[model samples]
Target: MRTDLCGRLGSGDAGRAVTVCGWVDRRREHSEHLAFIDLRDHSGVLQCVVDGARDLRSEYVVRIIGTVTLRPEGTANPALATGEIELQDCEVELLSRAEPPPFPLDERTDVDETLRLRHRYVDLRKSRMQRNLRARAALNRAIRRAMDAQGFVEVETPMLIASTPEGARDFVVPSRKEPGSFYALPQSPQIFKQLTMVGGVDRYYQIARCLRDEDLRADRQFEFSQLDVEASFATRDDVLGFVTRAVAEATVAVAGHDPGTFDRMTWHDAMERYGSDKPDTRFGMELAELTPVFADTEARVFQAPCVKGICLMGGAETLPRSRVDELVATCQRWGAKGLAWMRVVAAGTGGSALDAGVAKFLSAAEGAAVIDALDASPGDMVFLVADERPLVRHVLGLLRLELGRPPVNDGRFNYLWVVDFPLFEALNAEGEPIPSHHPFTMPHEDDLPVLMSGQPLDGEALLGLRSQAYDLVLNGWELGSGSVRIHRRDIQQRIFEVLGIAPDDAQERFGFLLDAFRYGAPPHAGFAVGLDRLGALLVGEENIREVIAFPKTQSGADPLTDAPSPIADTHLQELGLRVLPPA
Candidate 1:
């Protein structure tokens, strides 16, 4: 007899005969005469009752032929939909018995993550994992719906392609047919998606998988999926606006709340105000500049070039000297030389009271000016970094994020548009300028002459020459980034020159994209949203692995599958590879 899924049985089907099939979630002997089993499937859970003569165990594959009956008076469980009713079984068959599980399947059980990952299949049976997977499915569906509604045609890009080593390392696959040749998995479908725009697929979208060989973080994985999109005849504003709306809709649909509208900020403003492009706006405590106020001061720390400060709310008098020292140590870890701090206090009849660190260096007027500039209150403390602009910004930005309270369950989303990114970052170890985002990003039209003139451009000037690039940030986490691509061959060539990519190297590495651009390429731009990060955020988990069915550990090792293992010699021969002995 055919059976229905366990989660489908409910109070509406009471008094009707039904066949149910699922894994026994939990089994309990209600009394000597009766037994109740909680059965679960991918959809949800249901309760099943059988005579005590039959034996059932947890995780056993079971089939029951019974009538769905409403629970007796005072027995209905309001916590579950199927709780109001249960299946009264007359016949039961134990399809497969299960051994004792290594770990509990309930959400409340606190188990070691290493053990959980080792038995991911069993771990996925837990309620938390079930919820995460369901939320992931719903999020993907919402993304598809949103993209389709925006007139974007869904398309698939290639998986294997040439390696353009720029931002991150590539995972290479040896080619058996071509000896000594290798193919790298696409870091992103960046080139292919741009080519799709050139092919005149006015608008395109793909739930694409990307692989990158890089250091792992809570939000990063070896192979992750992204909601990739590209649009022809679109500007930076059009793409940013589309992503903002799509993110808001997706967040509301998946998390049951809207993220609301995003605030726009330039790279400079973000650095000066919050010290991070992805700033957490949920709380106060913005960074302020004190360079002008300390320009002529006798303070040795402020004697250097750029000086910026951030006032910790209600932190001046309360923050201890040891805590301030610890903050300084944290800055040093991020490559800052040292950290300088001053406590704001009330002015006395004799003179202005100040922290010992800067008391002798500052005159009364200068001290007051510093306090007024930062808008410091009596109880607030101010921390300053004095160094080059980039280091100062980096140090302060990191401190700002670190000092804020852990993210809370606030329903409102703080969205931001980080625009005006630099086209080229500083020179690499080889003294060649590197692409800030990527080589395909178009330089600002007005900056083309400056780029072609071959004049040496510093980081500040290059940053001011903004590209048509932008990143979508939600609550200080970068959701995605995109830029209007370089379509003109001459402009593309100029970018290559700026990045120190030789003519021969450019033709070899990016010939396919260049040739495609030559054939009627339109003005197009695209962005990629990290599906794993989005899923994790929607499920309210700290790490992306919580939502993934099978995720590798921080070391990029999969405990369940034991991947990255050495292959047999025969298999290696097929791939034209040989394992070298450890030197």
Candidate 2:
């Protein structure tokens, strides 16, 4: 180790003798008496001129003592941080010699992901991974600071807790002490944070680790982190304010700008206008209702349950006839009966220019109505889907994205809140209801009487009930959600009744939490932000794996350690466990 990092050296250190240590990025031999080596550390790379023997190779960890000097005229590397100066008269001491990397250490192209993961220790040496992980750490620190400033106390929740078969499948741990029993990992600190509120910790937070035994995607991992928070006697606005402050802090720390006041949209508005709970309000092509436009039409299909369309300006030229067929096939795959489309042709005629798809199903007047309703201009393309309202939204939503409708960046953060979601969805004909957020979420005040009425709800009535829940969405990704909790036992019991969880079953599954409520649970609310997703967003990475230091593959395998491997028989026997042979 020397007096400076290889990257931090500059012309200001000229005529100064300094020591630097790092891996040799590259070595160039001009002559036997003079050779140059690019020295690299976490900070960056520096060029070193050694007027002696040249034995350096890539990844050879070395220390150098040399005098910094201005580079010869016309020899400056404007691309490098230390380009203006080079270390001369260097004495090199090899600390470690590294074998040639399996993949080039400086490669910028795609490498086999599995291979890179297997050699993850080597893969982490790349500059991109370094920057990503660094940004994550800095963002985490920023989150902690924000929580601290907000008078929140960080608390640790249990890793081995009782399993609540409510949300995602849990990764269970066999309890040797209790022979056939098991402890499940926490998916979120949901229960414990609420318990903290019951224990009178008015404001609480935790940078908690969570696990879920679910299918993996780019944005999901079996084990992830979140900023868990809970507060007693807090209103919906209070929780939103807290989240905004923390999110702003994290975003500014990484992106170098504060996302001004986040926009708000009701869940109904999001779904109606953009066809998603987390709408990407970045660009156009908003979904338009064509129900009224076709209500009086003789076309049976077009006048049916619901009709929605999107106008793709200039899409007629950009997207070909084949693309329309592909899009229609995609919609059908998503359960749509069929996809309807019309490409507008610019003509100096006295009638409509609708050229294809269901154009035959409409009169010139109906076609004109469709054109004016979607605001279609010359050469524009209109795509429509008809079915049940939800299916219509779902199909058009998928088509909108397929047509390149997504988040619009306004040179800043597109932070937003989606609120007033349905409290329950129909589970089945057995009369069981699925709580949209969870069983304990407080129903909207206006819907309180509906819940208290004791009248069994079915279909639309159940779906129409809204909850106090809110989700923080950024660029179409749902960052996190929170809601006011039902502090009263009666309201909680009503929810349990709706979910078909009898008093006995409720006590058996959530006995501890319910028992805690018996001791006067306070009116509390909370939110947990997916730290991985937040970090990925701040770093502008679509996949959360990029920001994670050691991310699992989509298959949930740890390539580096080859984890989830078979355990020793003796070890399994200690816990009275055995691995069954594959069928």
Q: Estimate every model's Cα lDDT from 0 to 1.
A: 0.81, 0.88
TM-score quality measure for candidate 1: 0.92
lDDT of 1 by residue, 1-583 (tens): 5467777777788888988777888888877779888888776788888887678888998878889899999999999868899888557888999997898888787999989999998998887898898888888888888888889999998787887856679999899899689989999999889989988899999999899999888989999999898999998778877677677778888899876667898877887888887777777678778788878878777887888878787777677889888998999999888887778666666333456656567777767777777788777787788899888988998888777745634555677788887786676776666777888898776777887786876655655666777787766778788998988887888778766789899988888988888789998988988888877777678788998889889999999889879888898898888888999
- In model 2, pairs of residues that clash are 282-407, 282-408
Tens-digit lDDT track for model 2 on 344-405?
88657754479877788788887887788888988889998878898999888878877864
TM-score of each: 0.92, 0.96
Clashes of each: 2, 2
RMSD of each: 2.7, 1.8
Q: Model 2 residue 364 lDDT?
A: 83
Total clashes for model 2: 2
